[model samples]
Target: MSGTRATADLAARYRVAVEADDPRVLIPLYDPGALLDVHVPHWRFQVEGRRPIAEQVCVLPRPGRFTTFDGEATRDGLLVRFEWRQNGPTGDALVRQLHAWRLRDGRITEHLVFCAGVWDRELQQRMAVEAPLVRP
Candidate 1:
């Protein structure tokens, strides 16, 4: 557990943990009674406890591997914004997410997430042609 928390970069920890597909790597990063509040579209759900949060995070059906992740540390905690996508013949599914985590005692006590929902290649193409973004 200490091994996982040795580094101060939380986003690096996440990249390692997710890439390794190891939930144990994140268990120590959260408080025993950690809270996770997730919001997607018009839906919201909550999960409590470190073990549950760790497990839940690992099982999330992200589009695929993360495309990008950026973390901004704040006085109380930090915010991580990232995207996931899988480009292949099957389809190119993309999902965007943001997480605001409050840390204390080197462990996260609260985590709030906002998900933009999933978009397949078709939808992505339509949106791109219909409404092009001036900025990425």
Candidate 2:
């Protein structure tokens, strides 16, 4: 269970977990001892173990809607990306991110994530208008 097929499977499970907002839905994909490394702006931190990692990673911290994109397999893992859309105290916002996952025996042993900071709806629209995506 490696390569593109495995990556696809991981995406399906991840998407299901996110949509269900259930950490339990994501636990099975993780090893008993798994690590979640997160990077945002100039800061970085980690969450350890399947339960804790699943708990933190399964859903957005605050109220929000999100869209999951397709994942691609790397030599030892897969890259999973998504967008978070939220309406906060200020207004509508967006955050984009991707996770680089390492799997073995069909279970995730670790994953690293880099986040694109949150942007208000206005900035999102401006970026959309000004920046033509070279690739989706």
**CA lDDT, every model vs. true structure:** 0.80, 0.81
Candidate 1 residues 1-136, lDDT tens each?
4423432477688767865668899898898989999999999999998888887776545436887887877777888888878766678888888999888877789999899988888899999999998997
Top-TM-score structure, candidate number: 1
Clashing residue pairs found in predicted model 2: none
Cα lDDT tens digits for candidate 2, 1-136 = 5367767987888877876688888888898888999998889999998888888775464567775566778888888888877766868877789889998888899889889888888888898899967885
The alpha-carbon lDDT assigned to residue 70 of candidate 1 equals 79
Worst 10 residues of 2 by lDDT: 59-68
Residue 120 deviation, candidate 1, in Å?
0.7
For model 1, the superposed segments whose C-alpha errors exceed 4 Å read 1-8, 88-90
Candidate 2 — which residues are off by over 4 angstroms?
Answer: 1-3, 59-63, 87-90, 125-136
